[model samples]
Target: MSATISPLAPKKYPKMPVIEGVRIATAEAGIKYRNRTDLLAMVFDPGTAVAGVFTKSKCPSAPVDYCRQNLSAGKARVLVVNSGTAKAFTGKKGRASTALTGEAAAKAAGCSESEVFLASTGVIGEPLDTNKFSHLLAGLVKDGKPDLWTEAAKAIMTTDTYPKVASQTVKLGDADVTINGIAKGAGMIAPDMATMLSFIATDAPIAAPVLQDLLSRGTAKTFNAVTVDSDTSTSDTLLFFATGKAGSRGAPKISDPKDARLGAFRR
Candidate 1:
């Protein structure tokens, strides 16, 4: 996090409300900075659907590869993100670090390693010391709460001067569903895919395929439409998750992007 806030930042931040089935926690791992948060963990309720889009760079980060491989499962239970280490260009060591983090997150969330998602940003090429913070995951997940959107956004900052967060409530059928998102990036952003790193979660009962379609379409107008210095980072990533908790409130489960009920959300 920078010592100065960006002048373009919104003067009045939106009030973020709790999204059901999602809990978040942030910790200080001293990865690069001391006495400040550098790690974030988000635990989603079981049955949450996930979708993602990554950088177009030929040489992406290890965590990007890890996430791409696991995305085929279309299910998510835990998301672990950190700053101070991009974990790119480290070859085998980078892969090993991602594997270790995924395993630790899986163990903490009591889910399969394939269901755990990870993203990292910061210094590239240098090996990330997982030993510094991997053990803190279990405690973070155990104490996670649904109201840490701002803290979670702050924890993933690298060059960002201010935390980026957004929230909105939309009517899905007769039920109102909430969506919450956080992102980090101040430079190395372009139109190749994600501008930096973003994570979004919703309480709507949407299927994985539907969520993927929605995200893929929405990005063309959102992240893909933004630019900063015309440089794309190897760690650019955007992940979307949907916890089907809203089904109990009369929100119909949607599996197709063409569903008419999504008209309001797609707008």
Candidate 2:
């Protein structure tokens, strides 16, 4: 936790709503910090479509590389994030750590390794010990529940003055869809493409390509517009996951980003 909260911090944190197909759990891994949680895992139900935007920095973190490769799959089962040891510029060790962590998360979620997404933030150039948290995946998967959004936000903070969270419930076609987002960053702003790190999950039935389109367009005016510093972080990342669970409740399947039915959601 940061000793001094940022003056720009929100006056009050909003109550985060639970999205139907997401479960989150946090653990204390002591990666580069002590006496606080430094690891987080978010499990998404099957059929979750994913989209993301990352820093355009020439040198990105190992987790950033892993996510860029996996994003093309457009599907996600689990997201693993750590707050200390950025896992950047560590060469072979960083890549090996990400691979080990992804494999461990996949096994815990009973999903393919390619479907696991990862992000890391904090000090760059230090080797992250995957062992610090990989063994906790099985337990985290079993203990995770859908209502720990606030805790999940805090667990992934590096120098964040406060946990950032936002939620919105809107009518999508005939069903109500909810969007919940969490972000962490107090420094290393001026994102070339994304914030320091953020994750959003919703129960809307949007397709991957369409979700990517929406996320990319939306980020331009939001995350991309904010700049706390001129430096772009190598670990900047933002991911959005949409679990198609709302389809069962009559939410229209949106495969096109320009569909008129997305009017409310687009706002």
Candidate 2, 145-240: lDDT as tens digits: 999999998998887878888999998998999999998887767856544699999999999999999999998988888777688889889999
User: What would the TM-score be for candidate 2 when compared with the true structure?
Assistant: 0.97
Q: Per-prediction RMSD in angstroms?
A: 0.9, 1.1
**lDDT (tens digit, per residue) of candidate 1 on 188-208:** 768665448899999999999
State every prediction's TM-score relative to the real structure: 0.98, 0.97
Strongest candidate by TM-score: 1
Q: What lDDT would each prediction earn against the true structure? A: 0.92, 0.91
The TM-score between candidate 1 and the true structure equals 0.98
In candidate 2, list every pair of residues with a backbone clash.
none
Off by over 4 Å in 1: none
